[model samples]
Target: MQRVKPGDGRALKRFRWWQSLSRALFHLRLMDGDSGQTVYSVDVRHQQHSSSSGRVVAHLYLDGRHHAESTVPAVFPVQGGTVEVRASTVGLKRCHYVTAEGAEFQLVPDPASAEGRRARLDRSHPALSRCMGFLSGTVLVVGVVLLALQLAEQITRDPEGVAQYAGTLTSPIDLSGWANTVVGLCTVAASTERALRLRYNWLLDGAAG
Candidate 1:
């Protein structure tokens, strides 16, 4: 555990390796209500339990002080906005702090986390990051297309009236079971990487999930 500052009331969270696949950390800063010049920080960690049905916890901090906490979907009232957090099996799908004026901003990860490292990479090497992002989107799109074709073939193979109207369908990229397993794993990795960047397309990424 790390403190936001020396003698600060709240314990700043440090990312752990074991939670790499199941945890997300985010931070937000705002003007303090009590002090005009002092700024406050809201730190939140979305940690999911190991079980499939386990719940996720969102811890909120204010000005390095423990302010409030809740489980998804969490809503914490703060200066000029409300901090909201949401989670999924893969990690956080939403962690935006929305202002009263309708402006929205996402809380980024702490500098020590894996997500933070990736964000730093984007800042330092934008072209590479963009390429990786595009690659992830492409992978998800391919997965979605393959899944749709397979589903269509499966549906048309046995159905009578539908098959008669649409004709029997066949997937163009048929592969062995081992090949499919490799593709599935690659798709999952792509989706997870996109999730780290907070980039998601419902049609493409959802199908991968």
Candidate 2:
């Protein structure tokens, strides 16, 4: 973790309405025993054009002031625990406060952001949220299956050398150009929805990414 230099008095910028789609802000409040409560915030800007290396950095804020900044996945020490932050191609994959005793708690998302809206939906309509989550997973699974079949068909198209080892294989489903494009769009949408909830699986979401 990179600490904010003492003399570097840069302040945390306010979250703008237009940046909701490309930015994430999360907050965690912890009780410091007899010392009372402490608040920590994690901020990430997904579209940082100035970052030549294309790495997303997470900024740590203490009680609304700039405290530290680090390239994710980052871990910033706090009063009682550490704030862990991670980002993905679409958005943040993880943002949690982990106590020294190993207890983990997800930080609260800023109400104005996309992630916050999705989380609000989950809380207000749990059944509907669950249905949406199921649909997203199903879509991703279908996409991966179709991709695997297409890859297999391509590999076995010219199986002259490998014919002796294994029989030629063919894809059961052959989608047209427009149909494949539709599927691709659906997969992207599904992945984006999952990202809003900070849900990611190396196999399912990774393929979409």
Candidate 3:
């Protein structure tokens, strides 16, 4: 096998090539490349097989930032072909792709060897769930307060009898606004929790490096 130095480009351009291949999986990483920042990196994952109908795709990476991904489909007529990619930017460009080379390929997800991303997310923190509960409770409070205010307003509207409930008027929360706020808060909390879990897992797996 031979290596080639395919130098710098833009942020989303691909910069490497696999001239020919058959039945395999591969990984590519750019340790440092791009014009925006020297801290950027990239990783590409390609999986192909004899049974695969198309070429294995090499997901793109710019200065470590994930911008685009596409699979190279396996072609018919039973023949070999080239796979290529590029780097977008400049600075110590390491253009390399890793391939899983072996015979008797078997498709399977290794459990013991598999990284437990899902389980880790769930076991992350009680704070996330509790924050969700808090947003739900806010909805209840908003409803109760709005209902009480509406009732008082209705009672005071009676013409004949004197309206006894006299209090300073000021709306605490709008119904629609409260609902939207609650929903948004919950969504943000959930997303944040997920992001935190993912980052933590990556760090654990040494992928953050």
Candidate 4:
């Protein structure tokens, strides 16, 4: 991680209502023994419209002032621990403080952000939250299975000489154009829902994204 020079004195930008779709903020607090408590915040702006590289930067703030900034996955040294930040295509995938002894704590999302709203829902309605999570996973699973079947059918449709080595295989389920479009839409929604909770899987969510 690149460290911003000390005394740089850059101010952290205030979160705007419109930027909620493309920005994220999270906070962490730690006790500093005799010094009492210390506060740290992380701010990330999505680079979807700004950069071709698709990489976003995470800014670390001490108390409420800008301390350092680095392109994620970023690790910033803090009191008694390090703040780790990572981002996915749709949203954040990780933001936690790792202690010297290996303990990890997720930073609290800003109440105005989408992630914070999701976390609030999880706290207020655990059962509904669980059901939603299950639904997201099921949708992704169905999407992946359908994708695999479609690919198999396409490959086997024109096997050519390869049919001799591996017999042609056909997909059992055939989806109409509209049905496929629906599935694609659902997959995107599921991935977005998972992203709001900072939940990501390399195979399932990765493929969906």
Best by TM-score: 2
Q: Residue-wise lDDT of candidate 4 within 118-168, one digit each (tens)?
A: 999999999999999999999999999999888877777765755556778
For model 2, residues 1-209, the per-residue Cα lDDT tens digits are 55322223367677778987789999988887876887888889987622644678778887778888777788888887788887888888899989999999899999888888899999999999999999999999999999988877777667575544676777779899999999999998999899899999989988888
Q: What order do you get sorting by lDDT, best first?
A: 4, 2, 1, 3
Total residue pair clashes for candidate 4: 0
Which runs in model 2 stand beyond 4 Å of their true positions?
A: 2-7, 33-35, 49-52, 161-164
Model 1 scores a C-alpha lDDT of 0.71
Candidate 1: residue 91 Cα off by (Å): 1.8
C-alpha root-mean-square deviation, candidate 1: 5.4
Q: Model 4 compared with the native: what TM-score?
A: 0.88
lDDT of 1 by residue, 13-130 (tens): 5577766665576777666666754333433344533244355656676555666655566677767877777665555667788999999998877676667778999999999999
**Candidate 3 lDDT for residue 173:** 46
Number of the candidate with higher TM-score, 3 or 4: 4
Instruction: Tell me the tens digit of each residue's lDDT in model 3 across 170-207.
Output: 44544576665664455433333332222212221111
Give residue 155's error in model 1 in angstroms.
0.9
Error of 1 at 35 (Å): 2.7
Q: Indicate the worst ten consecutive residues by lDDT in candidate 2.
A: 1-10
Q: Which lDDT value does model 3 have at 208?
A: 12
The C-alpha local distance difference test score for the whole of candidate 2 amounts to: 0.84
TM-score rank, highest first? 2, 4, 1, 3
Model 3 misplaced stretches (Cα beyond 4 Å): 1-123, 162-209
